[model samples]
Target: MASDRKIYKFDEVVHHNKTKDCWLIINGKVYDVTPFMDDHPGGDEVLLSATGKDATNDFEDVGHSDSARDMMGKYYIGEIDKATVPLKRTYAPPQQAQYNPDKTPEFVIKILQFLVPLLILGLAFAVRHYTKEK
Candidate 1:
Protein backbone atom coordinates (compact mmCIF):
# COMPACT_ATOMS: atom_id res chain seq x y z
CA MET A 1 0.00 0.00 0.00
CA ALA A 2 1.20 3.49 -0.79
CA SER A 3 1.76 5.52 2.35
CA ASP A 4 1.24 9.27 2.56
CA ARG A 5 3.37 9.58 5.67
CA LYS A 6 6.07 12.23 5.57
CA ILE A 7 9.37 12.52 7.44
CA TYR A 8 9.46 15.54 9.74
CA LYS A 9 12.09 17.68 11.40
CA PHE A 10 12.79 17.31 15.15
CA ASP A 11 12.66 21.08 15.42
CA GLU A 12 9.08 20.98 14.12
CA VAL A 13 6.43 20.27 16.78
CA VAL A 14 4.85 16.85 16.44
CA HIS A 15 2.78 14.03 17.99
CA HIS A 16 2.93 10.54 16.58
CA ASN A 17 2.59 6.85 17.50
CA LYS A 18 2.37 3.40 15.92
CA THR A 19 -1.42 3.58 16.19
CA LYS A 20 -1.56 7.38 15.65
CA ASP A 21 -3.88 7.66 18.63
CA CYS A 22 -1.69 9.23 21.24
CA TRP A 23 -0.19 12.70 21.06
CA LEU A 24 3.41 11.62 21.59
CA ILE A 25 5.14 14.96 20.94
CA ILE A 26 3.34 18.28 20.92
CA ASN A 27 5.32 21.48 20.54
CA GLY A 28 8.21 19.27 21.97
CA LYS A 29 7.17 17.08 24.90
CA VAL A 30 5.27 13.82 24.78
CA TYR A 31 1.61 14.74 25.08
CA ASP A 32 -1.67 12.88 24.75
CA VAL A 33 -3.02 14.47 21.54
CA THR A 34 -5.49 11.71 20.79
CA PRO A 35 -8.51 13.25 22.46
CA PHE A 36 -7.29 16.82 22.15
CA MET A 37 -6.80 16.82 18.38
CA ASP A 38 -10.28 15.48 17.71
CA ASP A 39 -11.77 18.00 20.08
CA HIS A 40 -9.36 20.79 19.12
CA PRO A 41 -12.19 23.15 17.96
CA GLY A 42 -9.84 24.49 15.21
CA GLY A 43 -10.40 21.15 13.48
CA ASP A 44 -8.10 18.13 13.66
CA GLU A 45 -6.67 18.03 10.10
CA VAL A 46 -4.08 20.79 10.57
CA LEU A 47 -2.92 19.75 14.04
CA LEU A 48 -3.16 15.99 13.48
CA SER A 49 -1.47 15.98 10.09
CA ALA A 50 1.04 18.67 10.97
CA THR A 51 3.54 16.08 12.19
CA GLY A 52 6.51 16.79 9.83
CA LYS A 53 6.38 20.47 8.98
CA ASP A 54 6.95 23.78 10.75
CA ALA A 55 3.58 23.97 12.51
CA THR A 56 4.27 27.45 13.84
CA ASN A 57 2.01 29.11 11.24
CA ASP A 58 -0.84 26.68 11.92
CA PHE A 59 -0.42 27.07 15.69
CA GLU A 60 -0.44 30.84 15.47
CA ASP A 61 -3.79 30.89 13.70
CA VAL A 62 -5.23 28.50 16.29
CA GLY A 63 -4.93 31.09 19.05
CA HIS A 64 -2.90 29.10 21.57
CA SER A 65 -1.38 30.77 24.63
CA ASP A 66 2.20 31.96 25.18
CA SER A 67 2.81 28.83 27.22
CA ALA A 68 1.86 26.75 24.18
CA ARG A 69 4.49 28.62 22.16
CA ASP A 70 6.97 27.85 24.91
CA MET A 71 6.08 24.17 24.68
CA MET A 72 6.45 24.05 20.88
CA GLY A 73 10.23 23.67 20.82
CA LYS A 74 10.03 21.14 23.63
CA TYR A 75 8.06 18.58 21.57
CA TYR A 76 9.57 19.11 18.13
CA ILE A 77 11.17 15.81 16.96
CA GLY A 78 12.41 15.76 13.44
CA GLU A 79 15.56 15.47 11.35
CA ILE A 80 18.91 15.93 13.11
CA ASP A 81 21.66 16.66 10.62
CA LYS A 82 23.78 19.25 12.44
CA ALA A 83 25.30 20.35 9.14
CA THR A 84 21.92 21.05 7.56
CA VAL A 85 19.55 21.86 10.37
CA PRO A 86 20.46 24.48 12.95
CA LEU A 87 19.37 22.75 16.14
CA LYS A 88 18.17 24.78 19.08
CA ARG A 89 19.63 23.60 22.37
CA THR A 90 16.88 23.38 24.94
CA TYR A 91 18.13 23.27 28.54
CA ALA A 92 16.98 20.12 30.29
CA PRO A 93 16.69 20.43 34.07
CA PRO A 94 18.04 17.00 35.06
CA GLN A 95 21.02 17.46 32.71
CA GLN A 96 21.85 20.92 34.13
CA ALA A 97 24.05 21.81 37.11
CA GLN A 98 22.46 21.77 40.57
CA TYR A 99 23.54 22.52 44.13
CA ASN A 100 25.90 19.75 45.21
CA PRO A 101 28.30 19.40 48.14
CA ASP A 102 31.20 18.42 45.90
CA LYS A 103 32.76 20.81 43.43
CA THR A 104 32.94 19.71 39.78
CA PRO A 105 36.32 20.00 38.07
CA GLU A 106 34.59 21.17 34.86
CA PHE A 107 33.06 24.11 36.73
CA VAL A 108 36.47 25.00 38.15
CA ILE A 109 37.96 24.98 34.67
CA LYS A 110 35.19 27.25 33.36
CA ILE A 111 35.78 29.72 36.19
CA LEU A 112 39.50 29.74 35.44
CA GLN A 113 38.74 30.27 31.73
CA PHE A 114 36.65 33.32 32.64
CA LEU A 115 39.52 34.75 34.74
CA VAL A 116 42.05 34.29 31.89
CA PRO A 117 40.50 37.11 29.84
CA LEU A 118 40.72 39.52 32.78
CA LEU A 119 44.33 38.51 33.34
CA ILE A 120 45.15 39.21 29.69
CA LEU A 121 43.48 42.63 29.90
CA GLY A 122 45.51 43.49 33.01
CA LEU A 123 48.70 42.34 31.32
CA ALA A 124 47.98 44.48 28.25
CA PHE A 125 47.41 47.58 30.42
CA ALA A 126 50.59 46.99 32.41
CA VAL A 127 52.69 46.55 29.25
CA ARG A 128 51.24 49.76 27.71
CA HIS A 129 51.97 51.78 30.90
CA TYR A 130 55.52 50.42 31.28
CA THR A 131 56.37 51.02 27.61
CA LYS A 132 55.03 54.65 27.78
CA GLU A 133 57.46 55.47 30.63
CA LYS A 134 60.39 54.00 28.58
Candidate 2:
Protein backbone atom coordinates (compact mmCIF):
# COMPACT_ATOMS: atom_id res chain seq x y z
CA MET A 1 0.00 0.00 0.00
CA ALA A 2 1.06 3.61 -0.55
CA SER A 3 2.13 5.02 2.84
CA ASP A 4 0.32 8.30 3.63
CA ARG A 5 -0.93 7.96 0.10
CA LYS A 6 -3.95 10.02 -1.02
CA ILE A 7 -5.89 10.17 -4.21
CA TYR A 8 -7.51 13.41 -5.39
CA LYS A 9 -10.77 13.23 -7.29
CA PHE A 10 -12.30 15.77 -9.70
CA ASP A 11 -14.79 17.47 -7.38
CA GLU A 12 -12.60 18.99 -4.65
CA VAL A 13 -10.93 22.42 -4.41
CA VAL A 14 -7.98 23.31 -2.16
CA HIS A 15 -7.56 26.79 -0.72
CA HIS A 16 -4.03 28.06 -0.21
CA ASN A 17 -4.27 31.48 1.45
CA LYS A 18 -0.53 32.07 1.67
CA THR A 19 0.16 31.95 -2.05
CA LYS A 20 -3.25 33.14 -3.19
CA ASP A 21 -3.64 29.95 -5.16
CA CYS A 22 -6.30 27.27 -4.95
CA TRP A 23 -5.67 23.64 -5.83
CA LEU A 24 -8.24 21.08 -6.85
CA ILE A 25 -8.95 18.40 -4.29
CA ILE A 26 -8.78 14.84 -5.54
CA ASN A 27 -9.59 12.39 -2.75
CA GLY A 28 -9.85 14.11 0.64
CA LYS A 29 -6.92 16.58 1.01
CA VAL A 30 -5.65 19.94 -0.25
CA TYR A 31 -2.36 20.72 -2.02
CA ASP A 32 -0.76 24.18 -1.99
CA VAL A 33 0.29 25.03 -5.55
CA THR A 34 0.82 28.78 -5.68
CA PRO A 35 4.54 28.33 -6.21
CA PHE A 36 4.06 25.83 -8.98
CA MET A 37 1.87 27.86 -11.34
CA ASP A 38 4.58 30.11 -12.70
CA ASP A 39 7.38 27.58 -12.38
CA HIS A 40 5.47 24.75 -13.99
CA PRO A 41 7.11 23.28 -17.08
CA GLY A 42 3.77 23.38 -18.94
CA GLY A 43 3.57 27.20 -18.76
CA ASP A 44 1.28 29.52 -16.79
CA GLU A 45 -1.69 29.26 -19.13
CA VAL A 46 -2.31 25.67 -18.26
CA LEU A 47 -2.22 26.38 -14.56
CA LEU A 48 -4.26 29.55 -14.97
CA SER A 49 -7.07 27.73 -16.72
CA ALA A 50 -7.45 25.47 -13.71
CA THR A 51 -7.38 28.36 -11.24
CA GLY A 52 -10.38 28.31 -8.88
CA LYS A 53 -11.55 25.15 -10.64
CA ASP A 54 -10.98 21.44 -10.25
CA ALA A 55 -7.70 20.62 -12.01
CA THR A 56 -7.70 16.90 -11.52
CA ASN A 57 -7.96 16.28 -15.26
CA ASP A 58 -5.25 18.83 -16.03
CA PHE A 59 -2.81 17.52 -13.40
CA GLU A 60 -3.08 13.96 -14.63
CA ASP A 61 -2.43 15.13 -18.18
CA VAL A 62 0.72 17.11 -17.34
CA GLY A 63 2.43 14.10 -15.79
CA HIS A 64 4.14 14.42 -12.39
CA SER A 65 6.75 12.11 -10.90
CA ASP A 66 6.03 9.56 -8.19
CA SER A 67 8.05 11.57 -5.66
CA ALA A 68 5.98 14.70 -6.31
CA ARG A 69 2.82 12.66 -5.75
CA ASP A 70 4.25 11.40 -2.42
CA MET A 71 5.24 14.85 -1.13
CA MET A 72 1.88 16.39 -2.06
CA GLY A 73 0.09 15.01 1.02
CA LYS A 74 1.94 17.31 3.44
CA TYR A 75 0.24 20.38 1.92
CA TYR A 76 -3.33 19.10 2.23
CA ILE A 77 -5.59 21.33 4.33
CA GLY A 78 -9.31 21.05 3.46
CA GLU A 79 -11.79 20.72 0.63
CA ILE A 80 -14.10 22.93 -1.42
CA ASP A 81 -16.37 22.40 -4.38
CA LYS A 82 -14.98 23.69 -7.70
CA ALA A 83 -17.88 26.05 -8.36
CA THR A 84 -17.74 27.61 -4.89
CA VAL A 85 -13.98 28.22 -4.75
CA PRO A 86 -12.98 31.89 -5.00
CA LEU A 87 -10.20 33.45 -7.02
CA LYS A 88 -7.31 35.04 -5.13
CA ARG A 89 -5.74 38.01 -6.94
CA THR A 90 -3.24 39.25 -4.35
CA TYR A 91 0.06 37.49 -3.83
CA ALA A 92 1.86 37.74 -0.53
CA PRO A 93 5.60 38.44 -0.51
CA PRO A 94 7.92 35.68 0.53
CA GLN A 95 8.44 35.28 4.27
CA GLN A 96 11.82 36.27 5.61
CA ALA A 97 13.66 34.56 8.49
CA GLN A 98 16.62 35.84 10.48
CA TYR A 99 18.85 32.84 9.89
CA ASN A 100 19.77 32.20 6.25
CA PRO A 101 22.59 30.07 4.87
CA ASP A 102 24.05 33.21 3.27
CA LYS A 103 25.66 33.89 6.64
CA THR A 104 29.29 32.75 6.77
CA PRO A 105 30.16 29.28 8.10
CA GLU A 106 32.53 30.83 10.64
CA PHE A 107 29.63 32.75 12.20
CA VAL A 108 27.59 29.55 12.37
CA ILE A 109 30.48 27.72 13.98
CA LYS A 110 30.88 30.51 16.56
CA ILE A 111 27.19 30.33 17.49
CA LEU A 112 27.33 26.54 17.82
CA GLN A 113 30.52 26.71 19.92
CA PHE A 114 28.94 29.25 22.28
CA LEU A 115 25.79 27.16 22.76
CA VAL A 116 27.70 23.87 23.28
CA PRO A 117 29.22 24.82 26.63
CA LEU A 118 25.89 26.03 28.07
CA LEU A 119 24.18 22.83 26.88
CA ILE A 120 26.90 20.67 28.45
CA LEU A 121 26.63 22.54 31.75
CA GLY A 122 22.87 22.17 31.79
CA LEU A 123 23.13 18.45 31.08
CA ALA A 124 25.73 18.00 33.80
CA PHE A 125 23.43 19.67 36.36
CA ALA A 126 20.46 17.53 35.27
CA VAL A 127 22.50 14.35 35.65
CA ARG A 128 23.65 15.39 39.13
CA HIS A 129 20.08 16.16 40.23
CA TYR A 130 18.78 12.80 38.91
CA THR A 131 21.63 10.90 40.62
CA LYS A 132 20.99 12.63 43.93
CA GLU A 133 17.25 11.73 43.81
CA LYS A 134 18.04 8.10 43.03
Candidate 3:
Protein backbone atom coordinates (compact mmCIF):
# COMPACT_ATOMS: atom_id res chain seq x y z
CA MET A 1 0.00 0.00 0.00
CA ALA A 2 2.90 2.37 0.76
CA SER A 3 4.16 1.82 -2.79
CA ASP A 4 0.94 3.33 -4.12
CA ARG A 5 1.58 6.67 -2.37
CA LYS A 6 2.96 9.48 -4.61
CA ILE A 7 6.50 10.73 -3.92
CA TYR A 8 7.39 14.45 -3.72
CA LYS A 9 10.81 16.08 -4.05
CA PHE A 10 12.20 18.14 -1.15
CA ASP A 11 12.62 21.16 -3.42
CA GLU A 12 8.94 21.02 -4.43
CA VAL A 13 7.77 20.92 -0.79
CA VAL A 14 9.87 24.03 0.02
CA HIS A 15 7.62 26.30 -2.03
CA HIS A 16 4.45 25.82 0.06
CA ASN A 17 5.46 27.67 3.24
CA LYS A 18 2.83 30.43 3.20
CA THR A 19 -0.49 30.71 5.09
CA LYS A 20 -2.59 30.09 1.94
CA ASP A 21 -0.20 27.42 0.62
CA CYS A 22 1.53 25.23 3.17
CA TRP A 23 2.87 21.70 3.17
CA LEU A 24 4.71 19.67 5.80
CA ILE A 25 6.94 16.62 5.56
CA ILE A 26 6.93 14.61 8.74
CA ASN A 27 8.78 11.29 8.87
CA GLY A 28 9.11 11.35 5.06
CA LYS A 29 5.36 11.61 4.42
CA VAL A 30 4.11 14.76 2.65
CA TYR A 31 0.95 16.48 3.95
CA ASP A 32 -0.80 19.48 2.43
CA VAL A 33 -2.20 21.03 5.64
CA THR A 34 -3.40 24.31 4.09
CA PRO A 35 -7.10 23.57 4.64
CA PHE A 36 -6.56 22.68 8.31
CA MET A 37 -4.26 25.65 9.00
CA ASP A 38 -6.83 27.93 10.66
CA ASP A 39 -8.35 25.02 12.52
CA HIS A 40 -5.02 23.86 13.99
CA PRO A 41 -5.04 24.02 17.79
CA GLY A 42 -1.64 25.74 17.91
CA GLY A 43 -2.74 28.18 15.21
CA ASP A 44 -1.50 28.37 11.58
CA GLU A 45 1.83 29.97 12.54
CA VAL A 46 2.84 26.81 14.36
CA LEU A 47 2.24 24.75 11.17
CA LEU A 48 3.81 27.39 8.91
CA SER A 49 6.96 27.43 11.06
CA ALA A 50 7.52 23.72 10.42
CA THR A 51 7.42 24.09 6.63
CA GLY A 52 10.35 23.43 4.19
CA LYS A 53 11.88 20.76 6.42
CA ASP A 54 11.33 17.37 8.00
CA ALA A 55 8.93 18.31 10.84
CA THR A 56 9.04 14.88 12.50
CA ASN A 57 10.90 16.21 15.53
CA ASP A 58 8.57 19.19 15.93
CA PHE A 59 5.49 16.98 15.58
CA GLU A 60 6.73 14.28 17.96
CA ASP A 61 7.90 16.81 20.56
CA VAL A 62 4.36 18.14 20.95
CA GLY A 63 3.19 14.58 21.75
CA HIS A 64 0.14 14.68 19.51
CA SER A 65 -2.87 12.56 20.55
CA ASP A 66 -3.90 9.32 18.78
CA SER A 67 -6.87 11.11 17.21
CA ALA A 68 -4.51 13.86 15.96
CA ARG A 69 -2.23 11.18 14.54
CA ASP A 70 -5.22 9.53 12.77
CA MET A 71 -6.25 12.91 11.34
CA MET A 72 -3.08 13.08 9.21
CA GLY A 73 -4.57 10.63 6.70
CA LYS A 74 -7.09 13.21 5.50
CA TYR A 75 -4.32 15.66 4.55
CA TYR A 76 -1.92 13.01 3.25
CA ILE A 77 -0.78 13.88 -0.21
CA GLY A 78 2.42 11.85 -0.75
CA GLU A 79 5.78 10.74 0.63
CA ILE A 80 9.02 12.66 0.22
CA ASP A 81 12.01 11.25 -1.70
CA LYS A 82 14.54 10.26 0.99
CA ALA A 83 17.39 11.00 -1.39
CA THR A 84 16.23 14.61 -1.82
CA VAL A 85 16.12 15.28 1.96
CA PRO A 86 19.18 17.20 3.19
CA LEU A 87 21.18 16.10 6.21
CA LYS A 88 20.46 18.43 9.17
CA ARG A 89 23.27 19.47 11.49
CA THR A 90 23.04 18.52 15.17
CA TYR A 91 22.50 21.56 17.42
CA ALA A 92 24.69 21.90 20.52
CA PRO A 93 23.83 25.04 22.49
CA PRO A 94 26.71 27.01 24.01
CA GLN A 95 27.56 26.04 27.58
CA GLN A 96 26.75 28.69 30.22
CA ALA A 97 29.56 29.81 32.53
CA GLN A 98 29.47 28.19 35.94
CA TYR A 99 28.15 30.64 38.56
CA ASN A 100 30.61 31.01 41.46
CA PRO A 101 28.78 32.58 44.41
CA ASP A 102 32.09 33.66 46.00
CA LYS A 103 33.43 35.25 42.77
CA THR A 104 30.60 36.53 40.61
CA PRO A 105 30.58 40.32 39.99
CA GLU A 106 26.80 40.55 40.22
CA PHE A 107 26.72 38.66 43.52
CA VAL A 108 29.46 40.88 44.95
CA ILE A 109 27.64 44.00 43.75
CA LYS A 110 24.37 42.91 45.39
CA ILE A 111 26.09 42.25 48.72
CA LEU A 112 27.83 45.63 48.61
CA GLN A 113 24.57 47.41 47.73
CA PHE A 114 22.92 46.03 50.86
CA LEU A 115 25.86 46.17 53.26
CA VAL A 116 27.26 49.57 52.21
CA PRO A 117 24.16 51.50 53.23
CA LEU A 118 23.95 49.65 56.56
CA LEU A 119 27.63 50.34 57.25
CA ILE A 120 27.19 54.05 56.42
CA LEU A 121 24.14 54.40 58.70
CA GLY A 122 25.87 52.57 61.53
CA LEU A 123 28.91 54.85 61.28
CA ALA A 124 26.70 57.95 61.18
CA PHE A 125 24.85 56.85 64.32
CA ALA A 126 28.08 56.01 66.16
CA VAL A 127 29.58 59.43 65.29
CA ARG A 128 26.44 61.25 66.44
CA HIS A 129 26.31 59.33 69.73
CA TYR A 130 30.01 60.03 70.48
CA THR A 131 29.79 63.77 69.58
CA LYS A 132 26.59 64.19 71.66
CA GLU A 133 28.22 62.55 74.74
CA LYS A 134 31.22 64.98 74.42
Model 2 Cα lDDT, one tens digit per residue, 2-53: 4554444333332332234545444434566666654566754455555444
TM-score of each: 0.31, 0.38, 0.64
Candidate 1 TM-score, C-alpha based: 0.31
Q: Find the candidate with the highest TM-score and give its number.
A: 3
Residue-level lDDT for 119 in candidate 3: 100
Best by lDDT: 3
- Taking every candidate in turn, the Cα RMSD to the unseen true structure, in Å, is 16.6, 15.0, 12.5
Writing each residue's lDDT as its tens digit, candidate 1 over 68-117 gives 66654444433332232234434311211244323467788899999999
Going through the candidates in the order shown, the clash numbers are 13, 6, 0
lDDT of 2 at 82: 40
Tell how far residue 53 is off in model 1, in angstroms. Answer: 2.0
